[model samples]
Target: MDRQKRQLQILDHVDLTLKEAEFVSVVGPSGCGKSTLLNFIAGLTPVQSGAVEVFGAPPGGTEAPLGYVFQQHALLPWRNVLQNTVISLEVKGIAKAEREQRAREMLTVMGLDGFEDHFPREISGGMRQRVSLARTLVDDPRLILMDEPFGALDAQTKLLIQEMFLKYWEENRKSVLFITHDLAEAVALADRVLVMSSRPGRILAEYEVGIPRPRTLDQVRHMPRFTELHDAIWEDLRGEALKAMQGRA
Candidate 1:
């Protein structure tokens, strides 16, 4: 509960866990504290009650690497691609040569190879997002939190980035907590999907993707199991979505 507004509870008794190399996606109606949950895991918000542990340790203050890719590109306009990618490392006091080398390698893997010197304004939105991903991943964070990182992109760019992200996850196998509202995108990208309640957010249900990985979004959406899972989750989500909308109205 907010001390300022005692009745304004954001989340209540929400429980979640992401295993090693596991990819989990969370979906719910708007204003369900989905981002609040991410903030808790990222250590940006204080845990008012209950507990949050990463690898059996409290998050935020450890040397353990943690990465976050937000909805916005959040790239520095003045900094070139390579420079932006290594900013985290620079803050960590890594040697300049080592940080640049790692950042360059990640940028290359992200398909930004020849655009190292390009500023944020010079690149497309999609390319800027790739740089953001490269920056977050360059430090090799064991846990990654992505809050609708592709939510702002066009359909084509979203699909392309999904594929790119899948490739990166397949190669590195990092534990990820992804927040997205698109049911199809959630099922396509995650090993498991979590649904939350309308307000005072809580986990409503969990669905295993069951679909094979190395999955292309187009291919997975066409599968029978994908449809089944999507429909089933929608049954639970639809009501909450309606309730949220009505509350807004």
Candidate 2:
């Protein structure tokens, strides 16, 4: 499909029968059009040819209310955490009192209870990302799209957020389309993992993660099968990652 000047072709189509409460991860080498596909779903970019259906409706035309967390926190530095979170609802014409109340409830869930009045500059990177998640979740989206939502955090923070994400997912159970380049992250978080190839991206492999849930970062690291799956996916992604790096170099 060609939108504007960009072309998107899903050479190896992977059908996603996401249930009401499942987390699905898409992992691929950087620049494999992962973000592009997410944009198509978000209606930020139109699907020129191939169909994109979310909850049985074409996304670019009549999509569900969506909550997206990008690679960056994308929080407004000027707005305090609470104010920043209410932007989306405000745009939708939701009342200030109701939205703020909902936003506060979300902030509490994300561990930012007392920090609501703090500016984005006042918080740590991980906390900023949490604020970003809070901002998105306040709207009660049917499906949340996460594009490397924790890619920029430190290793320790990444692990913390991964655990936090698991807790949140378990509680909310919203259908998720999480895109990440981190193999372990995808394996640790998703019910099914979609692996894609390089440019003119195609789904190369799809693996259903049979591991038991409430999986913490430590438990995932220690799982015997985790190493096996990681190695297998890494082997698949290595060539593409190297190719992408070389192109950039």
Candidate 3:
């Protein structure tokens, strides 16, 4: 969507892009329509105004390459982890051999090396999320839309998953639009960060994370630049969050 006159019931004057292989993050207070914005881009919610295009094509159009990882691990209960990861390929009518191979590789990369036969219930929350990421990445979509995929995990688990995700991104560099409430996460994983305002959400601010390349999640946090960016982003985000909580914006 262009920056000009963009609007939706929950979003307004919004414009953004995930350049080829670039990583981006959006942060804002609750109800700022962050998730709503993602829904529009993923084509789960139609744009009531302006437009949302993926890879220069309308969301879900034939030319768009997209994948989404929702906050909840929406895994199939009856299916084993391996089966769940291969479902998308299976739907595309890929040969069983090829699909399973792709899924296994992705699962291994996501750090789900051996629990392939386990059901979702048999694994920990973080592993379940690893399976979710595995499922999404197996499709090899050019653009990934993540909606707080790590929000439910404990601190350690979240950090572990974030590290895994960053490693994957560093190597593959697929375009990503990650949504989160964690300022540290936003700054750590994205090349660019966006802050949205309260209901009737709009872009409030943008930050470019310039801590340098070959950055590690652990190392970045201790860097002076990381703290600086985090503080700066929070200064902008905090106000909107308060405004949202107070219902004054």
Best by TM-score: 1
Model 2: how far is 67 from its true place, Å?
Answer: 1.1
Roughly what TM-score does model 3 have, to 2 decimal places?
Answer: 0.94
Which model is ahead, 1 or 2, in terms of TM-score?
1
lDDT of 2 at 54: 80
Clashes of each: 0, 0, 0
Candidate 2, residues 54-94, lDDT tens digits: the string is 87887855348788899999998999999999998998899
lDDT of 1 by residue, 93-194 (tens): 999999999999999888998999999999999999999999999989999999999999999998888899998898889999999999999999999999
What global local distance difference test value does model 3 have? 0.90
Ranking by lDDT: 1, 3, 2
Count: clashes, candidate 1: 0
TM-score for candidate 2, residues paired by index? 0.91
Query: Can you give the lDDT of residue 22 in candidate 3?
Result: 89
